[model samples]
Target: MLKQTANMQSSNWIGHFIKITAALTAVFILCETVLYLTNPNNRWTLVANTSLKDGISNSLVYPAYAVDVAFQDVEEYPLTEPLIVNPLPNIINDVVLPQNDTFLPVHLVRFYFGLPHGDSHSFCWIDCISILSIMLYVKPSKIYIHTNYPDYWPFGRCDMITDWSLIQLVYTRQRFHLSGRRITFYKHEADVTKYSVAYQYGGIVQDSDVFHLPKMVELLRDWKNKKYQCLLTREDHFMNSGFIACPKGHPYTHDVLLRYRDDYRDPPVLYNSADVPWEIYNKNKDYQKNFFVDYQMGNHSWDYKGPIRYKEIPAWHAYWHGCDENEKNTVQLAKNSTYWEMLHFILAEGRKALIAVFPTTVKP
Candidate 1:
């Protein structure tokens, strides 16, 4: 009787072990599938077709927000060499572009916001650092800033960031924080129309909150010589104004700014428009009547036509933006992700250095 009881116990233990192993294996497979399917690059269909656009003649082709996946793959298995950021040698040739200097070099710009006015200082500062890490990595030539303020405050306090001169460039602030920066931003004016007046030549504009990957500058230089006068970025099915490139004084710059301003005037009845899916800007009533009218330049739809206008360039960071916790996590994860690692390699030898960040609310 004792032997039989022991045999039963052994069988039960083995059975439980097999069940546990199977469950773990299933989970591993599921996780891999999820990551693969959701990867932004894997879904190439999400990007607009490039073949239809005209190529720049004698101009260097600067790619926007686009990263080659193979480059990222190689970076994952880096050799023992110490990691350092450096510019690619002969970037003009490596990127496959003829040199043209008639056009001024384009500078891609983005800004960083810590949090809404009323959020906890800890949360807001963490948010600011998360953006700062990526900005330090990109080291852009121009930066525009928008934040909240009591107009002035003690150093280290959350509202202290309102001092715009700290970050430099053109600065503005919202009247209230609870207004939601996006809504408040829509209410204010955009500098797009003032490109000619503000800049000697046109430069690119990128939303400050987005993160970047490697060799982005090379891509920008590559297309500079191209005939296209402007470039727009897309996130899957949506076209985003967040990333834009135009020559100084280009007509499109003024057009886009004027259109956005008009939209802000009456605003699309946003409260009634929540049902529109994320990234579908055209479907929004305000955008439909104004921004989406022209399909060739890029319509209101998320997935517009290929090879944007001569005034338009391809945009890469179309999939990410805004301040939701999930969006913020993705941005943070990217801070240490393989994407930025390659950038660290490419950025190691660049000339630009750290600049002071000023509060936006304070006037010069």
Candidate 2:
């Protein structure tokens, strides 16, 4: 009787073991399938190998996905060959050109925003207005928003934007974190991303808080004509990285990237984005002459009660500074302010008209 009971117990144990193994195997297969479907590299490969038209269609279907997936892959796997510098064509003197004429080569405007703590994905009124200003004034071929979280769309005031075709989201990893430190600053990560994007793709890198003006068009033309390696703006006594424009494979941007990679120090030291560029400016005397630096780019005063500089209003920062966090209040302020009329004029009469009939002072 004892031998029979032992035999039954052994059979039950073996059956349970087999069932557990099968369950684990099924789980593993399911996980692998999910990974294969969602992996960015695999998706990028499938899209990149397709025809150009099909690739564009696929990107349009998912606007928030990384449009520069191939670039991201290249970064992951370092290229052995030297980086190529494609010379940009000069802009024609006349603004209006023939239908077949290509004005510039793929002007890419980039903005970087990081969502570290998984906080709100919604953009503030200031951000919305700033982007709207860029779309209206800069007339970029494409605007890429590089962020750690690519799934940040459909939140906040994005509905306010009418056109979604030109905008894209790119996934980027944070580069400025200490090995064992728990603290990370979003500002540093943004700095690194902007420099990297400018070096890799060659275009304008703008801060979310800064507004674009018609004057920027002229600066871009100068960049192309003079063959300036990079463009920066001066705010007060120091150079501000709020706005940076460069062509791909420029040594200026590459130097900034190298500085970040090698000399990046944790917070409290505070010298990465604007400071590094300023340092480069001081070190290289010729850089000052070669790189275009405009004083009017970031001239907006921080104090809400301070006088508003009419001339510097185009590339102003923090237009909604002093307004309540409520969106309605912001909208009302805009309607009551000269900015409303200014925007209307730009949209209706066009940027050229606005520049021709420049206003000295605007009343709220």
Candidate 3:
């Protein structure tokens, strides 16, 4: 009778322990999900659902994986052929072509990479939205996406994207040719490539994160008539490398490239790109006229930390509130938010007026 009672007690204890373990596991998962959803950076990982892979070259380069992730249940969305360029030509040694006298060639350049943990397959909705903004506003002749992995094209959300012909994937070498030099940080690599591409192509180089505005078109048109070799924007007191427009063989861009090639070392200098331009601008006061630094252009509230003085809603609020764990819910929220409003404005009257009007002072 005692043995039976002990057995019953042991069984009851085991059941209780199992229940407690499961409860803890559930709580942990809930916490993880909440954290991931709240963080904007994690949205790409959530949407892609891709296994993180090391070394971009080792991964298989195919559109099938992208299509599967981007268009899983949508039957109406048809597959489209993506334009890709394998083994991008070495333009480093090539002579800088003469500037296009009529207008800055409508070529737009952007660099995309999944570095630190190279997952070439990962792309977010914001990336697509940014591209769409550029397409709608700037209407570039060609949009070059310089990437380490050439095979991986972001076609997952092609249904939302309009022009496939505008996008061309150019494969860039992981190492620089100066004594076979390699950049330790991917950000530096982007800095070097931006100048190189601008030097070679003689167009606009914009960061992938920035959304192009309608006024940008007018600004570019105005730049063509001016004598400035490059047009740069100011973020706070320093010059930002985010948006740059210059002609082919511009001396300013060439100088920036030389700085990176000669001065850049293993322990990377933080903000080397931004600093180079800022220093150059200050040192050569006479040459300042050659570079147009617009204080108002590209300035937005996203990076601003000041109190809410303006009626315009902060971009962070729009993005964060609109994001959700469910892809459809996220999409729907984005459509209803200020982001969609801006896109619509760009589409409707972007050619005639500015989509975003920023107050001169957001600082407290």
Instruction: Please name the candidate that would achieve the greatest lDDT relative to the true structure.
Output: 2
Q: Name the better of 1 and 3 by lDDT.
A: 3
> Root-mean-square deviation of each candidate, in angstroms?
23.5, 12.2, 14.7
User: lDDT per model, in order?
Assistant: 0.33, 0.54, 0.51
Model 3, which residues run further than 4 Å from truth?
1-122, 176-182, 265-269, 297-340, 347-364
TM-score of candidate 1 on Cα atoms, chains taken together: 0.35
lDDT of 3 by residue, 1-364 (tens): 9999999999999999999999999999998789656533233321222211221122232321111111111112222311111122342233222434553333333344432222334345555556666676666766777665555665464334544777776655433322234455656656656766665566777665556665666666666677566778765656666677776546566566566645655454445677777787788865586777876544555544334211232111211211122234445644555555454443344333333322242211
For candidate 1, lDDT tens digit of each residue in 1-364? 9999999999999999999999999999998888656642233322221111232123121221121110111111232322111111211123221123442332322222332233333223323432343344344443333222222221232231332233433222211211122334432222321222222234445443333433444445554655344555443444444445555434344333233323333244322112121234443454333331212322334432233222132222322222333322545544555433322322332212221332343243
Which portions of model 1 show Cα errors greater than 4 Å? 1-138, 146-166, 173-201, 223-227, 236-238, 261-364
Q: Model 2: per-residue lDDT, tens digit, 114-198?
A: 2322224456555665666677667776677755445556225543455567676655544324322322666655566666666
- Model 2 TM: 0.59
Model 1 has an lDDT value of: 0.33
